[model samples]
Target: MGNGLIYVMAVNIVIWIGIAFYLFSLDRKIKKLEREMNDPSH
Candidate 1:
């Protein structure tokens, strides 16, 4: 039972980490687009 609980916790942590990274990447892309829209010179 203890081993199963550990595995569940680890999986949850990994999923959250993945979500965090995905959101971070998406934010960067959105910011870049906003910058380009604000300044067409680029």
Candidate 2:
């Protein structure tokens, strides 16, 4: 029973990490777009 709990916890952590990385990538893309939009030459 303890092993099962640990397995579930590990899976949850992995999923959270994946979600965080996805959001981080999206934020980077948004910042890049914002920079381009604010540039006078764009």
Candidate 3:
């Protein structure tokens, strides 16, 4: 039973980590777009 609990926790942690990474990447892309929009050279 304890092993099962640990597995569930691990899976949850992995999912959250993945989501965090995805959000970080999205934020970076958005920032890049904003920079381009503000610059006339782009």
Candidate 4:
């Protein structure tokens, strides 16, 4: 039972990390688009 709990926790951590990474990437993309939109030359 202890091992099972540890495994579950590890999986949860991995999932959370993946979610964070995805959000970070999305945020970066949005910032880039915003910069382009704000530029006078665009």
List, in order, the clash count of every candidate structure. 0, 0, 0, 0
Best by TM-score: 1
- TM-scores of all candidate predictions against the true structure: 0.90, 0.89, 0.90, 0.89
Stretches > 4 Å off in candidate 4: 40-42
RMSD of each: 1.3, 1.6, 1.4, 1.6
Q: Per-residue lDDT for 1-42 in model 1, tens only?
A: 687999999999999999999999999999999999999999
Candidate 3 structure quality by residue, lDDT tens digits, 1-42 = 687999999999999999999999999999999999999698
- Compared with the true structure, all predictions reach lDDT values of 0.98, 0.95, 0.96, 0.95
Candidate closer to the true structure by lDDT (higher is better), 1 or 2: 1
Candidate 1 lDDT at 37 equals 98
**Superposed Cα deviation of residue 32, candidate 2 (Å):** 0.2
Per lDDT, the best of the predicted structures is 1
Instruction: Return the number of clashes found in candidate 3.
Output: 0
Candidate 3 has its poorest 10 consecutive residues by lDDT at 1-10
Worst lDDT 10-window in candidate 4: 1-10
Candidate 4: count the clashes.
0
Indicate whether candidate 1 or candidate 3 has the larger TM-score. 1
Candidate 2 lDDT, 1-42, residue by residue in tens:
686999999999999999999999999999999999899587
